[model samples]
Target: MKILWFSNIKLTETQMSGSGTWISGMNDLLSTYYPDVQIANVTIAKVDTVREEIVRGRSQWVLPKKTTAGDMDLFVKIIDSYHPDIIQIWGTEFFWATIPFETICPNVPVILDMQGFYSSVLDVLYGDLTMQEIIRCFSIKEFLRPSSSLIALSRRLHKSVNREEEVIRKYKIISVQSNWVKGNVNLLNPKATIYETRIALRPQFFQAVKWNLNRMEPYTIFSTASMIEPTKGSFTLLKAFREVKRLLPQTKLLFAGSIQTGIRKSGYMRLMEQFIYLNGLSDSISFLGSLNTDDLIKAYLHSNVFVNPSYAESYSLILAESTYLGVPTVATYAGAMGELGSSKSLLYFSKYDYRACASKIISILTNRELAVKLSIQSITFSEKKHDPKTVAETQFSIYRSVLGQLNK
Candidate 1:
């Protein structure tokens, strides 16, 4: 079988973001397990450069000439040349780009991976912003800037949010990472065929890491995100950390994610820095500034607990990774995080409640026996549910089922 995959981010740039890592990991799994299958991956390029290359053992990769309006023609020509059995578009942000596919590849089955619904995400991020602020934040030029990729992507996605029922009706199937996302998809396209496929941890995360329950860095709390966006609730985390510090004076909060510094500093970054200074947490809070997977694992290893203060998530990949690494976790009951922690392995608190969040973190940090129990439970759950082989097999079955329905 042949498959053509479309995503805004290149699989080669997997280390940069969450969706890229997911695409890269899934592609690797398919290549390793289903050797006979032919896969073509087409990604939007950052610059006005085109490349068609065959990696040593991976799929044929096609990067668009550019992300401009004129590049759509070149992208469609590449798709036609591949002659794929099915087309899988990774997210709804590419709805405009995929419109031509319906007429060009009429017989080919297309599957839309509902990574997350843009409307739901926007509701969380801009929930507090006024109409003027929303407009100012998402101008047309911002949507075209490659430097602001996430915002640009979100802007495009927002355009299609109301039209999802009409747009998704064209696809043969929809794949979602979690039941929470499936719920959102159902609301958008009730008739759409939805498949729930949980993402697996990368092989690196599955490796055995020693869980030092007895000897951990004193009162160290760790958290990570791809970027310090408003949706990530970094401010909420800071507030919660302050409460935790009040209780335990020696506690330190370590953040591992990208932060724009210097002149290019974002307004949010400035606000965070001001908050830290105002709260007199300069010494207790530390920003690691975007660690790679290996370093992230090390952060999880040294920390006493992991905290997820995000306002929403389709699936908390970092939470799963931290749990697998054997850190007792405390998270807000937002989006699919509750589902991920359904095994009751981690402590849960109401979203945006700083005191409650701090209380939960304190419980985990102060109680060694409770922390050890939660850590063991989390590790066992991650190993069983996030096994790479099991995930690959399940996804392969879903692909086969989609193909079978298309044949019928």
Candidate 2:
């Protein structure tokens, strides 16, 4: 079966990142495991590497990101050329990605892959940062820049949320990853048919370095997001870390992205910079900027615990990675983590409650036996859910089912 994919990232790049890595992995997997299911990808990225059907086994059209009517028309031509049995749009997060809806791909069956809505995140974008904290973090210079200003960011996100909601409501079929997403999707468009599916992680995560207690830094904590935005819950994590340090003085917090000196940071990050020094956590926090998968796995292995402080998530891929590798995890009961940790796979606390967050982290740190038990449970669940074979099969079946329903 010919399947056309509309993606936000150029998938075949040497340095794969985030959701793109898993999508490319699944594309390759579907070809090998289900040989009949052929795939093609059209990505919106800075690079322009356009290959046709004959040039590559499957066409990968990388269009320079544009949201014009002309771009949509050209996309139509590409779709006509490929003539896929089904068109799968990866996410509803971007304006460029909203092109291949039912209106554009009228004749074919299109399934919107539900990858967390910015509309849902828009509400918690400040990530539990109170008005007083906001007043403290406010900067006239940063606000003057327009792009990094808190007001400007909110306006842009509001626009994004409106577009995302419209796109989702128009699409009839969607693939949901978690209960949180399913709930949100129903609210946006209750008439839409929702299929629950699991995302496959990159191959490296499945077979990479495992997190063991023996190699862990005594009190090191790892977080995948550098808290580039408030939605990532950096402020929440930082508040929790302060409390954690007061109790366990040796504790260290490590961020995946660079929060280094001599860098222009976001409004939230600018606040983070001030808070770190104000709290005397200069030595306790470290940043590793832009990690490839290998380095990321290493960081995860070396840390004592993994924390996902996101106020919301469709599914935290790193959370999955950490759990899959049996790394002890603590997360807020926001978004899907509650459902994710329902099996007692990981520990949880109330969202935005730094004290509860600290308490949960402390529980994991102090009880080696409980940590090991949580790790094993998480590993057991993750092994089945993210098992490459299961993931590939589930998606392929969804495609087949989508096609089957069209006939009915």
Question: What is the TM-score of each predicted model, taking all chains together?
Answer: 0.88, 0.93
**lDDT tens digits by residue: candidate 1, 27-75:** 7677777877777777666445677766535455545444543455765
Stretches of candidate 1 above 4 Å error?
13-19, 68-73, 95-97, 126-160, 163-166, 208-210, 225-227
RMSD of each: 4.0, 2.3
Candidate 2 global TM-score: 0.93
CA lDDT, every model vs. true structure: 0.73, 0.79
Clashing pairs in 1: none
Task: Evaluate model 1: give its TM-score.
Answer: 0.88
lDDT of 2: 0.79
- lDDT string for model 2 (232-263, tens) is 88888898999999999999999996553443
Residue ranges of candidate 2 with Cα displaced over 4 Å? 13-15, 47-57, 67-70, 100-105, 258-263
Error of 2 at 355 (Å): 0.8
